[model samples]
Target: MKDTQIKKLIEAEKKRQKKAINLIASENYVSRDVLEALGSELTNKYAEGYAGKRYYGGNDIIDKIEELCIDRALKLFRLDPNEWHVNVQPLSGSPANLAVFTALVPRGGVKQEDGTTSVAGKIMGMSLDQGGHLTHGQKVSATGKFWQQIPYGLDPVTETINYDQLREIAMKEKPTIVVSGYTAYPRIIDWKKMREVSDASEGLMMVDMSHIAGLVAGGVYPSPFDYADVVTTTTHKTLRGPRAALIFVKKDARELYKKIDKAVFPGLQGGPHANQIAAVAVALKEASTPAFRKYANQVVKNAKVLAEELEKRGWRLISGGTDSHLILVDTWNDGKKREPLVKDAAGKAEAGAGAITGKEASERLEKQGIIVNKNAIPFDKRPPADPSGIRLGTAAETTRGRKEKDFKLIAKKMDEILRK
Candidate 1:
């Protein structure tokens, strides 16, 4: 605490968080125990490898801490240790995903005599504009640079995943892997259909359940373990843990666990963050309790209530409503029963009026102590910096003990701010 300047900034941030209405879907507040573990003396240690197999000496304690975290992660989701292998390293979600793809998916482009190369395989994932994460093969990410992405998106009419169309694309594109879970998506994914698509295409299936990991552990959302070959999730987000990630590999004849472990350690990172691992262990244990289950269910309920209230107040909701903690509200267009915009061939907007842009709405909300991110709607014409929608989530406020009525008021406040 000798660094007065840094301490003052940290205190300022604390006050800001306390005063603001946080609706960021991928964010959550951790407990004191988790914070204590994060700042523990374990950060001084350097354990350059997995538990009991470290390259450095005097790591017995670090080994125990990591192993406990791995065990708790499996136990929280009711996974059999024998059937699943957990990698507790991989700094965060993005790297965790990269490690998985690097381990399994082939980076095509062998040199060709004609000075052109063919893509040996593709990653079939939901399009980023349609609620998928960038790690799922967006053009700007490293994953896309190394491998091609075959993007699928929501149906124009229903604003939800068209499974039949997804199957048709998978069958034709023949992707190396089909990723099911998403970042901004609010509906429950049909894991069975994704599995069938993967099967028909003879590809692997991976689920990035980072957004809903806690809900799955609480038995409120469906677990992807039964369908996915591998599952990657962040310990933060709905998990309410430290900023860490876990990669779960299903034990099969393919020996994916070995590949994933190697990819995480020597493949992607050096010594794992022992302190962060310990904190994740605490959160996993905390998430296993009955109280966390109630919290998780309440998160979904609060989201539904907020979405309903917003729609009733004339805000446009993508996909009609949400089945999870996240809600996507179209802020650029007029309210429910609004007319559609005219578009050019490139899908750029040609005409619209009498509505607020996502960026303007977000800025207005923040001035009123509300926090939310401007996001892209499905088939959005606007750029990523200021799209047509703003995403909201209930986990953080719900953790602060807010309930249905609180969220209803939040919706009312948001509606008033945006409409102005």
Candidate 2:
């Protein structure tokens, strides 16, 4: 490493990771083998097309690497190669999702003065404020720009999904596709109910299982494959892989695989990152082992212990509890006397009692070597940047060999910090 500055920063990050109690739900630590693959010589090559159908000449080895990745991905998830097709070339989760929409959804077009047609589609997904990802067609994202989002939310009192309301919305909107998986959602999704909704609306079902892919692989969480027509997931997150994504399309009369493949290659990106693909292959193999299964189960257990401890400590948990590795806690005023901003005699806004915001809670936790993200809870009145809640996860800490006892202690520490 001749670049001394970059090397120093990398070393500093390593030290930081070693000391910090990582709770970021979207993050995880990869193995040394995955790291080696990421920095391998395969990065020097440019394979602009799929395996064996490449535009470049020196891609025979690249083809084999990619084929192995696709094979392991299928095998890890117990999917038959003949029944399911996977595209491992999309740079990350966002582009992978975009490729799916471009391939399957119908884009209604408007004629322009320059004799061109501008097109947009419709996507039905959970509302961002209620635990949806931005790629699920939130207004600020490009997914929203090129497509209109028909949003759904959780039940106000229970703070969990209401299948009846979701079906009604889907039936009314008749969106081109309905997305099931989410970012901040903590419970196991009812894929069968989602399937019914998609069926009633005559729309495609795509589940972005990016957050829970590893749990699904370990058989700890329900697999959405039985219901969803297509599934998109990032290899990172709970998958414990590289920062890559895979799009799996069910083979049927629709021929969705071909459309999505074209969208990923010529329709979206050029040469695939052969190195990242190889790393993902290693991860898929690793995830198939019995040891990884234990790790996945422990992840959920650790999250439960953490959530229960937090609740007992007087913190309000969204949905009351969790069935997955994620938990949302109302760290602010808990929707009670939330008037954190009030006018003084001079008509100037001032901070009031019990006014700790999510942002402040996150900062306080970070100061104590715990890392978490501020998030918006269901029916939250506070803004997204500094919402009324904080999201915590146990995957990374559990990966570091933390258990129920460790999480209990971590929860107690967290309660102490935030209460201050």
Predicted candidate 2 versus true structure: per-residue lDDT over 288-382, tens digit per residue: 99999999999999999999887766677899889999999877755464343345789765443344688999999999999999999888889
Tell me which residue pairs clash in candidate 1.
none
TM-score for each model = 0.94, 0.94
Query: Which residue pairs show backbone clashes in model 2?
Result: none
- Looking at model 2, residue 285 earns an lDDT score of 96
lDDT against the true structure, per candidate, is: 0.90, 0.90
Number of clashing pairs, model 2?
A: 0
Which window of 10 residues has the lowest lDDT sum in candidate 1? 334-343
State candidate 2's TM-score: 0.94
Report the Cα lDDT for residue 327, model 1: 94
| Model 1 CA lDDT for position 366 | 99
